[model samples]
Target: MQIHAHYNGAKPDPYLINHHLEDNRLSPESALKIIATSEPGGEAVGLPEFVFLNPQADPAPDKPLQYMIKELFVKETFRSAGTGRALMNWVIAHAQAAGCARMDWHVKPTNEAGIRFCRSFGADAVAGRVSFRLMLR
Candidate 1:
């Protein structure tokens, strides 16, 4: 139920959230995109979802901006309910409106379902990049 708790606003660890919020508030090129889904009668159907976006400008000003999807998630129970597709479509619309050339996000190689889902949107894995992370305490 950690996903449920997280989307319900129980910020067990506030450091990252605070940092991202601050960054969003301070930068025009950066933002936090949060989408909350609920029932028609105003009931919570599942946890809210969110994605972090950063619009990077191309070297050539004539080109459109590039939007990076820093993170994306939907509750496991809510998968295949059209929520993920709807959310991704919304992101795509927003990116287009913002004049973004493309919207990009990475997926773990082990997540075959994720890869398939992304591919459904015409997203292909970039051939030359490796994802790396370094956690600092």
Candidate 2:
């Protein structure tokens, strides 16, 4: 919820969150949710969510899977404390172990900090492409 609020600048609907969680539970391997904490059983300071994608035609023939990061959030207090980097490193390693050909994600054009963080990992944005969405509800 905190991560969602941070990005959206508003609280998310609890009903929607619960519904999303239940759906993920039904197909756990489709998504991965990771929380970072200072100690075992401690409060969360960061969260990263990624999904495994299997397309009809694999983008990389040698690797059958791909990873798409849905969200990556580190609390403001923990932003410069290596929390985000740690989360990203873990995700990258996990994707590699799962035979993912590539990993990609998006950052809002105005999110300079997010852009810098992604660039630090050598991530580049796809050129000549635009994102579009349709809200069914």
Q: Find the candidate with the highest TM-score and give its number.
A: 2
lDDT at 83, model 2: 91
**Per-residue lDDT of 3-117 in model 2, one digit per residue for the tens?**
7688679989999887877777435564565545563668778877777898665577789898988888888888888998999999999899999998888899998988999
Off by over 4 Å in 2: 12-41
* Candidate 1 Cα misplacement greater than 4 A, ranges: 4-30, 41-60
Candidate 1: count the clashes: 0
lDDT of 1 by residue, 93-114 (tens): 8777776666677788988998
| Per-candidate RMSD, Å | 5.2, 2.7
Worst 10 residues of 2 by lDDT: 30-39
TM-score of candidate 2 versus the correct structure, residues matched by position: 0.81
Error of 1 at 121 (Å): 0.7
